[model samples]
Target chain A: MRALLIRDLRLAMRAGGGFGLGLAFFLIVVVLVPFAVGPDTSALAVIAPGILWLGALLSCLLSLDRILALDWEDGSLDLLATSPLPLEAVMGVKAVVHWLTTGVPLVLAAPVLGILLNLPSQGIIWIMLSLGLGTPALSIIGVFGAALTVGFKRGGLLLSLLVMPLYVPTLIFGAEVARRGSQGMAVETPFVMLAGITAGSLALMPIACAAVVRVNLR
Target chain B: MKQETMDTLLSVHELSVARGGLSILCDVSFDLFPGQALVLRGRNGIGKTTLLRCLAGLQPVLNGTIDVGADAIAYASHADGIKSMLSVAENLRFWAQVFGTTDIETALVAFDLVALRDRMAGTLSAGQKRRLSLARLVVSGRPIWALDEPTVSLDQASCLLFAQAVQTHLDAAGAAIIATHIDLGVNGQVLQLDPYAATSNTGVPSGFDEAFL
Candidate 1:
């Protein structure tokens, strides 16, 4: 499992691996919001938390197909399936690595991008916190979607279509947490809900992903 | 009979396999012993690859039984499973690590990939890539090898090298089942798949409405 993780990270970092593409997409979305919504500071501040959460969610979506599609394309998934490591472990490692490479960076970059949207002073940390907690669920769920669609040609759009609906709970709870925190409202409920979703998906989704991957391999 | 049963590495009895819901090979049976190789011979699309995949546990068998230990087999399909971004050495090391083996030196030397070890896999020629893919079998350290069309892009010399590798494996009490056309000069029994070909049309329905047919 460690070897699979290391290989995936290396693959992502290599040229044409789509390593920084998600982060760049996140940056573009954050930067474009102020222009699209006009330069009204109060208006931007009102929507900053929601916009940031949506940006992070969409960025996570951008790389979902890559989690297993590369391995599936090169037949590494088939070989890995026959290895000593179980497919469940492989899916778990893929989710962790995806979070590390894509999710962690987006979480860290959220605060910096928050400034561009005139985010309220208090909301910065909460937005970052919500994203940090929410993106794991995104990665895990996205991997499931990747596994489900790995066998199809031009699966990217279908992957997005499949994963976006699953992202709703995390997005709603996450954006709500950020929004409430920014307004100095009670945040414990939504924050806990977001964390619960992340924890639950992290626990259960890898098995589902592995099962679907086996079917796809067949 | 007792000695043969004790030495048998893999045994398939009345195995039937399908692809995309179409039965391809039926009532196929074979037994493999240590220090032996079985070459599967058939025309194209005769279900050789599907049979190998079934033996390797990559896909489920449609019918019958394949008796082999779960972790004792290693499969090498046509895809090579090579990551283009990593170097040849890196590719071998990754598999070695996954299979929990420490010796990649032998594999690199065996495949004559030591010179190309540092070069990224994407940069290698087709034959070189095929060699690297075969090297993975050595790193795998599994006793039973299930290979499908493993010599697609190899030259005469490389084919001989592969045959030698199989010979060495057999000598070391390992076994292999290969699906190939050209003879690699290795002394192995041939299993012709034509006799087991399914008589029914096992392909996808001609049209959506053909479901009734």
Candidate 2:
């Protein structure tokens, strides 16, 4: 499993490193929102949490199609399936790697992006914390989407469509925690819900994603 | 050939397979023993790939039985499974780690990939990619190798390389089931699939939900 993770990381870093694409997209979204919303400091601050969470969510989706589709295309998935490694574990590892490459980078980059959106000094850490807590669910759920559309020739749009609805809870709770913290309101409830969603997905999504991949392979 | 006294490695009894819920092959049975090679021959679209896949447990058997031991089979097909971005050595290293082996050197030598070891897989020619794919089977260290059109892109020289690899594996008491249209240049029993092709009179509906209902 460590080999698979190391190999995937190497691929992500060397192969045009679509790794940067997600973070770049996040930056662009944060920067673009300010221009679109007309440079109002209070206005940017008012919707900053929503915009940041949405940006992170979209950043994840942008790279979701890569998780399993390449392996499936080249038959690495078939070899993995036949190996001693359980399909569930293969997918579980994939989600972890995706989060490491995309989610962790986003969390670290979120605070930096927050500055451009006129986020208050106190709110920046909360944005990072909320993302750090919530993006695992994003990667896990995105694997499910990738598995579902893996056989389709043009799965990018279909993948986004299938994964968008599932991202709702994470987006809602994630934005709420960041927003409430920024406004200096009570943040504990949404924070708990965000963590709960992350934990639930981490436990269940790998099995679900593996099942879908098996059907596609069949 | 000591064929009769050898212990059977795999046995399929009254095995049937379907594709898209439609019966494609029926009443197929074959026995494979250690050091034996079974060549699955058929015209295009004749279910050879499906049969190999079914035996590999990649697809379900519609109405029959297949016996296999745990961790006994390694499957390779037209898809080379080599990552374009990784060098040939990296690709072999990944599979070596996967099959719990540290023998990338043997696989590289067996498949003549040592010269191309440091070259990225994307830059290798089609025949070279096929060689890289077959080399993975060596690291797999499984008893039974199930291959589907494994020689699809090989030239005569590469084909000989593959035949030699299979020869050595069978020499080690391993068995193989090869699904291919061309000759493997290895001595083996041929099981033609056309004789078992599903006829319209089998009376099962094309779709399983309707047929099984």
Candidate 3:
């Protein structure tokens, strides 16, 4: 398990078309939001949470296919299926690696990306906090999606279609908390709910992902 | 001295696999022993790959459990199982890490892929990719190898390389079940199947091609 984690992290870091592409995609998403919504600070502040959440959500969507596709293509998935490591541990290691390479950097950079959208300084902390708590759920859920489409030829579009609906609640609650926190409204309920969603998904998604991977690989 | 010469490393009993109302393999039984190899020979649309898939546990058995005993195993099919986007070394490193091994460089050398070590697997020619995938098994060093057409894209030299590797593996008392059309030098036990032997509920096409539904 330790080896799996270390290896996945190294692959994500060393592999081309990963972090740099993900970062560029995230930047493009953040930069494009104000153009669509207009440059009004009030509008930007009001939508900052939504924009950040949406950007985070889409960026995660772009990378979710990475979860198992590489392993599946490389035949490592078969070795893993036969190995002593239970499939659940394999999915867990994958999720942890995804979170580390994709989720952490996105969280760290959210506030800066928020600035490009003219988001208020007060909301910066909330955006970072909500994303930190929320993006792990995205990675976890994304694994299940990736697993379901792991063997399909045109799985990228299929994966998005399958997992986007599932990601709705997280997007809503994450944006709600960030928006409320930015607006100086009472933000406790939404924050707790988002955390609950994150925890629940983290607890359940890896098992689900493993099952889907088994089905797809077969 | 009673029954001390059982060569089988894998034993299958009454195995059947079905998918979505289509029965693929039925009541197929076979045994594969150490220091021996089995060739699952059949025509296209026959259950050759499906049977291999079933044995690898990639596909579930509807009616049987394969007894593989307590030994390590590796499977490589025509899927080229290596990720195309990764460099040869990165690909090897990934599998080595996953399979809990550290001798990836030596495996690459054995497969003669050391020169292409830094090249992305996606760019390699068919034979090179095939060789790289085979190298993964070298790093795995498992007791059992379930390979489906491991020579699909290999030139004569690489095929010889693969044949030598399989011989070396079996010489170490390991077992292999290869599903291929061409022979692999070693005298292999043939498990030939006639896809037309499948009997349908209607009972009219037991041996007829039109009854192949």
Candidate 1 to truth, TM: 0.96
Could you tell me which residue pairs clash in candidate 1?
none
- Give candidate 2 misplaced runs (Cα > 4 Å): B1-6, B201-213
Candidate 1, position B145, lDDT: 91
Would you list the rank order by TM-score, best first? 1, 2, 3
- Candidates arranged by lDDT, highest first: 1, 2, 3
Q: What's each prediction's clash count?
A: 0, 0, 8
Q: What C-alpha lDDT, on a 0 to 100 scale, does residue A25 get in candidate 2?
A: 93
Candidate 3, clashing residue pairs? A74-B81, A74-B82, A74-B83, A75-B81, B7-B33, B8-B33, B9-B32, B9-B33
Task: Give the per-residue lDDT digits (tens) of candidate 2, residues B88-133.
Answer: 9999999989889888898899889999999999999999999999
The alpha-carbon deviation from the true structure for residue A96 of candidate 1, after best TM-score superposition, in angstroms, is: 1.1
Candidate 1 per-residue lDDT, tens place, B1-213, comes to 123356689988889888877889989988999999999999999999999998888787777888886599999998989999999989999999999999999998888899999999999999999999999999999999999988999998999889989999999999999999988798999999999999995544234232211
State the lDDT at A154 in candidate 1.
Answer: 89
Q: After superposition, how far is residue B41 of candidate 3 from its true place, in Å?
A: 1.1
lDDT by candidate, in order shown: 0.90, 0.88, 0.80
Task: Residues A133-188, candidate 2: write the lDDT tens digits.
Answer: 99999999999999888877878999998999999999999999999998888999
